[model samples]
Target: MGTLGRSGIVRKPNETMRMLVTTIIGVVFGFFIGVSFPTISLTKFNFPSNLIPSLNFTYMDNAWSSVTGHRQVNSLSGVPKMWVETNPRGAERLPPGIVTPDTDLYLRRLWGKPSEDLIIRPKYLVTFTVGLNQKTNIDSAVRKLSENFQVLLFHYDGRTSEWDEFEWSKRAIHVSVRKQTKWWYAKRFLHPDIVAPYDYIFIWDEDLGVDNFDAEEYIKLVRKHGLEISQPGLEPNSGLTWQMTKKRDDTEVHKETEERPGWCSDPHVPPCAAFVEIMAPVFSRDAWRCVWHMIQNDLVHGWGLDFALRKCVDPAHEKIGVVDAQSIVHQTVPSLGNQVSRGITLV
Candidate 1:
């Protein structure tokens, strides 16, 4: 005799026994499978202690030319002699303090390497572009910088006659005023060495000075924050208060759209700040890509770089970082009356 329920099906004792076993088996099997397949980790990985000791930075074959208009090959080690001399300015031979890697300034620039075990100097491609119309401190700046960075100077003559000057010879490309087309002014031109890679590219104005600026520390923070575009706090030329736009506060942003109904609510956009100036903007490779693409070759005379950069840093795609620890001096020459009003869209 078998018990029948509303389903109108009666299970024999053997059938019932089989059903019970199968249910038990299914639960056990599922447990085993779950144990075998552990959950995946979503957290980003950082370099382990052991691995950090073994890593080294190098340039990919002939990578320098593409980034800074140098077409020829370049070696990465044995920094040029010009960089090691203490008296870069020759005003007076700086005490070994200026050139010594162990000095406080050097360590600060290198970001506090207590031992070689913690030091990781990522390779970089750096450049400076100066236009003829502006007055600049080219010689002193170059000599001072050659100590830590390899720089290629691009002069905007007309486009055809532009040449690149390196402290030492290498296969870097040069552009003249005529041939110095709009693309050269784009961020991509400053970082063409795609094969041998640098983590960051510093494209600065010639009027800017890098006093007390520590490159190594700057790089560490830039890498850690993973900012696409960033700047150090600026100091005004008059020695008055330096100005910078306040960062977008997440709370203030919410209030903004509530106050102004129908405000273009873009989850992807970051709030526009007070201003993005062009003094010494630091760019990660990611920032460079977006900036390079937005540059309009048609606007031949450099005008919209800052706006373009500002527009490119979307909250959904990139982060903006500012460093307050270090500052660069802007040699404020009075603006020669070319009141170029920057209408907003881009840097």
Candidate 2:
């Protein structure tokens, strides 16, 4: 009877332990099935329908809201519609219909203009990068550009004060940063949205001699020919690299021309046809918007950009040309390339 009683006690505990283990295994298996096949309705598991609503099935949505502090609205199909976040600090927001100032305040301060005053909007905008040593060349170019275009100067030498020596400098918006390439400055400063008001944009090197180039005449020819990407014809003896860019007396603008030995033979190809060297290229505001996107942030010198300029304008041959009517001499100065810092060329 004592042995029978001991056996009964052990059997009762073993049955209880088996039941407990079965319950845990059932719960783990259900959880895994629920995760693995989300399409299965919770109601199929005999769970109370009301319990499903109380539990968060959209954990991702809840987590996203918690981290961003933004409430997300989901469609009946469970797709997110929009995310809305409210500023808890209660800072005043700008009222509707107020104009946000787009002009760079640092550039304005350099121009010695009041912060409240609006910048003078010009029909044409010209930009160039210069060193302190190239003041003479810049002075000539700025003088020509200032006649019809609002000039913006990017001084690589960082000598903003030295520009005071030139009379035309007073008319320009000057920004100076030391030892950076023209493309580097251009990427940061010449955002298309900011300069959208201008009809044309001329981005040129400071070394170009603009004695023969007329800013007014150049615009007239560009508008006449509908040239979206163009440059002044380089004089035949002015270190002529491309035959297409060299001046031709027969026409005002040439779209296709004979290329040098290394240039592409196909008239449709660039750096041979529909190409202007980046040294002194003019862009229509629309073309500038597209070209600005092509300028890589790390490619400061813009070495191979000429080949890609055709991508910005369709029928590039028709829209891109050399304006021989307003030719300019490329002095080809190595001013920017000579600046070496820590055995690396900055230009």
305: Cα error in model 1, Å: 3.7
| Stretches > 4 Å off in candidate 1 | 1-122, 131-136, 143-148, 158-174, 178-184, 187-196, 238-242, 245-275, 310-318, 332-347
Return the TM-score for candidate 2, rounded to 2 decimals.
0.68
lDDT of candidates 1 onward, in order: 0.48, 0.78
Give me the candidate number with maximum TM-score.
2
Highest lDDT among the candidates is held by which one? 2
Find the 10 residues in a row with the least total lDDT in model 2.
88-97
Least lDDT summed over 10 consecutive residues: which range in candidate 1?
A: 251-260
Q: Count the backbone clashes (under 3 Å) in each candidate.
A: 35, 0
- The sequence of per-residue lDDT tens digits that candidate 2 reaches over residues 105-181 is 22344445475454554688888898888888788777776455788889888888888887777767888888887
TM-score for each of the candidates = 0.44, 0.68
